[model samples]
Target: MSEITPDLVRHLGVLARIQLSDEEVERLTGQLDAIVDNIAKVSEVATPEVAATSHPIPLSNVFRSDVPGDMLSLDEVLQNAPDAADGRFRVTAILGEEQ
Candidate 1:
């Protein structure tokens, strides 16, 4: 099994953009080592001969056929808007900076 050391933990923290203290890195190293061991065991069981299955139960596409439906007019659609301008709904500015 691969040993996860402080260096490995620190590298992982950098990759994840996480700020960890020296003590946290030591704790995470042990935790990650155990997780890697569990994953290695899983890989051992997954052989070339065995078929990969994502879900335990059988699944089929339950979507209905695409059919054109009646659409409300622009005026009708904009009728319920808290704020509307011309023929469309007016929304509050999201960008903090005002132009």
Candidate 2:
């Protein structure tokens, strides 16, 4: 198990430019020790054959078959638009100049 000591905690606090009190350093040393020990335990159980995953359960993409369907005509599609150009939607200039 990784050893987390008061000296290490103080050194980390200095490296991080954090002013940790003596009491805080003592408390964090124990907490960090426990954390490292637990991580070590988990490492022992994780074997080469065991696939590492971010989530506990398996996941897959649920997608529908790509098939074209009937679509509304240009006029019908733009009927509800707030503003439209010759045959497309028109809005305020976003980039100061049109592309």
Q: What TM-score goes with each of the models? A: 0.58, 0.74
Top TM-score model: 2
Error of 1 at 46 (Å): 0.4
Per-residue lDDT tens digits of candidate 2, residues 2-80?
Answer: 4998999999999999999999999999999999999998999999999989999888889988999998999999999
By lDDT, the best candidate is 2
What TM value does model 2 have?
A: 0.74
The per-residue C-alpha lDDT of model 1 at residue 5 equals 86
Candidate 2 residues lying further than 4 Å off, grouped into runs, are 49-51, 94-99
- lDDT values, one for every candidate: 0.91, 0.93
lDDT of 1 by residue, 1-99 (tens): 458989989998999999999999988989999999999889999999988999999899999999999999998898889999988788988888775
As a whole number from 0 to 100, the lDDT of residue 26 in candidate 2 is 90
The predictions' CA RMSDs to the true structure, in order, are 5.7, 3.0
